[model samples]
Target: MLEEEYQPRRELPPHLRKAPAPEAPFSYELRDAVLADMPAVREIYNYYVANSTVTFDEDRKSLREWKSKFTYLQKLGMPFIVAEAPSGQLLGYALVSPWKQKRAYRFTVENSIYLGPAATGKGLGRVLLGELIDRSKAAGLKEMIAVIADQGAESSVALHEKFGFTEVGRMGRVGYKFERWLGTVMLQRSLK
Candidate 1:
């Protein structure tokens, strides 16, 4: 065998090395969602549905579906809110819908909070959830439930717990998504 020649590894020059990205200024205002906001809301939700197990939905939701939901929530006097940037771009959304269709379950609702990819890890979720809870209380809702996916949703579970939501139950392997079994952790909080 021929003898190998020695080679020296070269390091990139300081200016050539990649620098950390500068954080952009993030400011948003929370307000009640309007009919025009469904498209943006659908895009945000579809991102999770198509890419992560955080949502168990295997198919993307249509704009019509989102609009229908908005109408239903509006008719029920439920809280459906969005966070918008100064530039009028939607940052995220949070809502509470009836937990069950029965008349006896009218006082209870299930809460859902979804943030844009760029909006996570900046305490936006905390702000959104805080406002959601306050609005729910103002709407005379008595209880709020959170059904969180056990996989790829640890942050969601933690966020809910931080807001005084207690784990009421857990179901294992009850959902099949992404070619794998998934489970859910149910948490509940009293708005009263």
Candidate 2:
């Protein structure tokens, strides 16, 4: 091997290193999601599906699938909302779906929240979740559940806990994604 190839990589001196670019100021409003927002919502979700363990879905979802989900939530009178920038860009989304199809489970729902990469860590999740809880309560939902991945999703766990969700149970090695076995942590909160 050449000497250049054998040499270890060198780090830049602190003074010579480039600083990270400052994030642009951001703001958004939350509203009920429309059919038109499916494309943007799909994009945000597919990003996590393709790049992270946040979601166990390995295949990218199609627009048709998103549209179907939107319609299903609509028919069920579930809360499906989005955060939009002043310029009409979707920053994130939150929704609740029936936790189970059994009649006994009608009053319980599973919550899902996803944010665009640039929209995370800016308090958007807190706002979205807070509003989702309020809407679910208004809709007569009595229980909300969050199924979060055990790996690569610590922030999600913390966020749910902040909203008073408590660990109900856990399933180990229930998912296989990205060449690894994954597990889930279940958290529950009461609306009543």
Candidate 3:
């Protein structure tokens, strides 16, 4: 949970404010997330929660809370993967979790992807998501959905489009963050 004085979603500290300048291609590997990667995972997620409307949650979660969520995903056998640079930096992560808990919804999943603030615009998202799609299919998932919280996230939307996801729905003014009414766009693709 965030303190009462937490920064508004629209206003972030300099480091978390914008995508860093793009860097030359670097060595990176896509692999299954380990129990030790939760801190890096939390760091990336908390940035979005605290600094942008990419996520609707306004409060940063504690490490314990995140580990609990991590464990739950593991229990469900959902995919959780991380992007690690050769230098040992955890650049980003992508995962799939249940879209809903109903028995009838077991074959569907919601996707979440996040990159380190400095790691944006470097094309890691494409790599992570491609691998995620392969793994999801291998796990026998029938559909994958992305609930994008910001309509202005062009890159994310474009990435999904490039991978065959189509805009299935939008809920305008459905979320209030940073003292403004925000919207959510949902995109989906079939795994089969």
**Residue runs of model 2 more than 4 Å from their true location after superposition:** 1-24
Candidate 1 lDDT, 104-142, residue by residue in tens: 999999999999998889999999999999999999999
lDDT of each: 0.95, 0.97, 0.91
TM-score-wise, the better of 2 and 3 is 2
Q: Which ranges of candidate 1 are over 4 A from the true structure?
A: 1-22
lDDT of 2 by residue, 1-192 (tens): 988679787999999999989977788899999999999999999999999998999999999999999999999999999999999999999999999999999999999999999899999999999999999999989999999999999999999999999999999999999999999999999999
Indicate the TM-score of model 1: 0.89
Q: Which structure is stronger by TM-score: 1 or 2?
A: 1
Question: How many residue pairs clash per model?
Answer: 0, 0, 0
Model 3: residues with Cα > 4 Å off, grouped in runs: 1-24
lDDT of 3 at 52: 88
lDDT of 3 by residue, 95-189 (tens): 99999999999999999999999888888999889999999999999999998876568789999999999999999899998899998889999
